[model samples]
Target chain A: MSGGSGTRNTNTEPWGSFDDHLIQGSGAAVIDMENMDDTSGSSFEDMGEMHQRMKEEEEVTAEAAATDDDTHDDGEFLGMKGLKGQLGRQVADEVWQAGKRQASRAFNLYANIDILRPYFDVEPVQVRSRLIESLIPVRMINFPQKIAGELYGPLMLVFTLVAILLHGMKTSDTVIREGTLMGTAIGTCFGYWLGVSSFIYFLAYLVNAQITMLQMLSLLGYGLFGHCVVLLITYNIHFHFLFYVLWLLIGGLSTLRMVAALLSRTVGQTPRLLLCGTLSLLHMLFLLYLHFNYHKIVEGLLDSLDGPHMAPMQRVARDVAELTLNASVRSLGVTLRAQ
Target chain B: PDWFHWTRTSFTEASRPFAGLSDVSISEDIPVEGDISVPVGSSRRDEEFSTLDEPVKETILRDLRAVGNKFIHVLYPKRSSALLRDWDLWGPLLLCVTLALLLQGGAADNDDQGGPQFAEVFVIVWFGSIIITLNSKLLGGTISFFQSLCVLGYCIMPLTVAMIVCRLVLLGSSGTVSFAVRLIVVTASFGWSTFASTAFLADSQPPNRKALVVYPVFLFYFVIGWMVLTFSPSQ
Candidate 1:
């Protein structure tokens, strides 16, 4: 569009003089010269002379208006207004450009990292550092970074403890007291680690993506599934082994989806946080149900054994009682016969 | 010369007669019960048993008392006196007996027709270990349920070794070199159990007394039932 047309569109508003000055301050000189060239039948050789004359005339008009108190008021007011508008537009453009650059850089860096290769010839390290630098300005002001750092060590310890306990329970020949103790230890550790890690990761990811903190927390709250899986594995390895594999697969897929979602920028923070939260909650509920039911089922089995089938403990107790009764009867018989 | 000879002869003659008379009296006074009495003699005096003053008698009595005291002390030391002061030795003895009986009962049930049921035997061993460990801590004057549990879990090392020994004894060698192979397998299995238990206890959170006991017991029963139902031979 022509500068004059742009100015005219902006001028129809209350700030017409301001818009005119802004148009003039921007690259309006080129437009003015071209317009003059079209109106005056000037040869290319005379364009420089024509431009000088136009500059002198414009300056004279500005000075004359500045000198005359009555004429200066309107002119000076419009000029200052135009200068302010022009400065605002320039600032806005710069900010918009910077934001675009950052978003693009983030997109590229994440995409490259997720796929396990560089998308361009740029060094992965350089790209990562730049992306981090860009993110730092935004992220350093947020809570997620602090929370993640705070949680990292505790989560590591918890996971390590859980792993150790799980290994112990699985290997223990005594599947009763000792086994259960080990299993519960494992579950507690797993639950604590999962809870902490999920919270941190959700917070970090959501905050980085500019989502609500509460939503992130809620999403992380769903990590109860991982805890339940840990409990299940402790109690019933046969069932839990399968469940564990499935969980790992799901976790991996979810991580991939999160990375993809963040990179794509198709869904903003709110929807992304909600999606992750819902998925996590569903998984957790399923896991909780499995664990709770598994415990019940085991209890039922014990009950069944106690009912008529005779658990080993019961059988031994019953046998001892029977033997005692028999011996007493025999002693009574012997005494009666003697009598 | 004749007078001096007579005096010497009289002295010799009188001493000989006295000695002869004393010997004869000593012989006469010897009791059939094997007691011998020293005879009163013209040449010497005999002291009564109560009036006797021998250096050896007091020394002997003192030595005997000292030796007897030392022997008693060795059998029951001063440190054990503290144990004894709290309760009579019979109390601990009875506790130990009760523990043994419970273990025996569990073990008896574990004996299968073919061989010892390893799972059942393991459970019994685990329980016995826990009871012994808890009693040990209690005797030490600490009532930490979690610490007892952890210690019991860790002490499964000894029980595991015992299990292996039992296995080797019950399941004799089959073919050539079978004995050595069985021993090795048993040893390895025991070692693994020991390591596993140690590692598990090491990782367990320090016990919170209120929650540790009941929850753990409930969990144990459930887990045991589940494991048995899932992995038992009958199942």
Candidate 2:
């Protein structure tokens, strides 16, 4: 409670960023001490008193910064300054070093104290409640902002490509091939998007705002790396659905981690418990839908792919087909020749 | 009469334990040093009781009274109840099932069709679920499985409406106009899905600062994933 009010004022200042409060509070505390001593006595008498008081205050401040207790370093101070003129420069250097060390220690102490002070004044229970309330806005704002910046950007690109591919397929006269390619592209895009998005959202839900955008991106990279691993596994196993499910599981696990962190930070257990229950219900439905509809969708796609269409070489279709086929064949031939 | 009966009954219940005690014999429990014996439940017995000594007795009685008060308070009826009174587990389950069914059904209907009708529907529902679920999970509220499914349903409703609008717009439009519209539609799907993917990852497992380097990597992979899925023979 020594500088409690001053600290509170600093903390409550409008738009008081972290550095602002630290610098302001420390400076104010020192200045308040200096002013109190200056106003206490007569000019000449006070001059001598002021000098001593200033020295005492400086020492106290330095000590407080170094350690809350002020007893240990008195001898070192006396030794450094006792024969002042004899080694004035040396003494000055020592003082300078002491100042640097003291300043750093003070900074460290201040940061620790500020973070811990909230716990002392507010019960852990109360702080937790506030933290949960605070989380709502933090989640809302952070979720959309991060997703818009990170997730949406890549999604846009993928959709564009898919659209182009679809357009190419639609124009193709080779009914079965066009249908098959189109179906595959559509299905794959659908599956990939579903898997990736689910995974990404899950990842987003797990992290805290203390995390920087860069860190989030990197974690996302890890998720994609996870995706790559899944893809490799899927390729080896030759099970598409498994791969999709695995991608989702990874996403879900990642999201669960974020959810856990958020829950840990949250004050009440009730809301989180409810939320989890709700998610479970939704998950079961999604699973059920996937189970029931997967075959029918696949069948529909196959039928569409096999439906009657123009001949194999409509002008636009011919151009794209030739280009893609040639490029792929060329790559294959090069690979074979290399082998 | 009601008040008297209730009070008498309560008092009787409270006093029953004390009434059951019979003999208090010091000599039977321990050999008496001299001839000092105390009678049980006598007026003089209060002074003989060690616990009845002024300071000690006061402390013991105070503690017992406090415990009895606490017990009585606990037995009192509660004042308020929870908001979710009629909530049932099956309701949420059914909603979730419905959403999943819609998604699967739409996908089936639209598959391999040159038209974007059902694909649009499936993507909308699927992506909507992803976004809503991610948000709900991150927010840490009592989001029931059914609530999430409902949210998924609600989120996709707009997309479904948009698809209908798109069809209407394309009816009288030129071929190039149609192409552009389709392009826009597909782009939106990809973009939204990609965003969902990244968001899902970001929200799920938060990486350290160094993980920002992975943004491009994720993007690259996302594109690759999209390509593979789109072009794979199985699809």
DockQ of each: 0.00, 0.01
Models 1 onward score TM values of 0.21, 0.23
For model 2, the DockQ equals: 0.01
Instruction: State the lDDT of candidate 2 residue by residue for A262-339, as single tens digits.
Output: 344333456556544443334333333332343344446556665756223222223321122222144554565577
Candidate 2 runs further than 4 Å off? A1-339, B1-142, B178-235
Query: Could you list the chain B TM-scores for each candidate?
Result: 0.24, 0.27
DockQ of 1: 0.00
User: Model 1: how far is A147 from its true place, Å?
Assistant: 18
Q: Residue B214 error for model 2, in Å?
A: 18
Error of 1 at A317 (Å): 42
Each prediction's RMSD over C-alphas, in Å, is 44.1, 29.1
lDDT of 1 by residue, A1-339 (tens): 122221121111222234333434444411221121111111321334444445545555554454465334545566667867656655665576557545544554222332322121223243334323221223122233311112112222243344334433433332333334444555655554465445545655654554344333322332332343354343433343455565655443433333333333324567556555654554445444433343343345546745866453222111121112222144554565577
Docking class of 2: incorrect
How does chain B of model 2 score on TM-score? 0.27
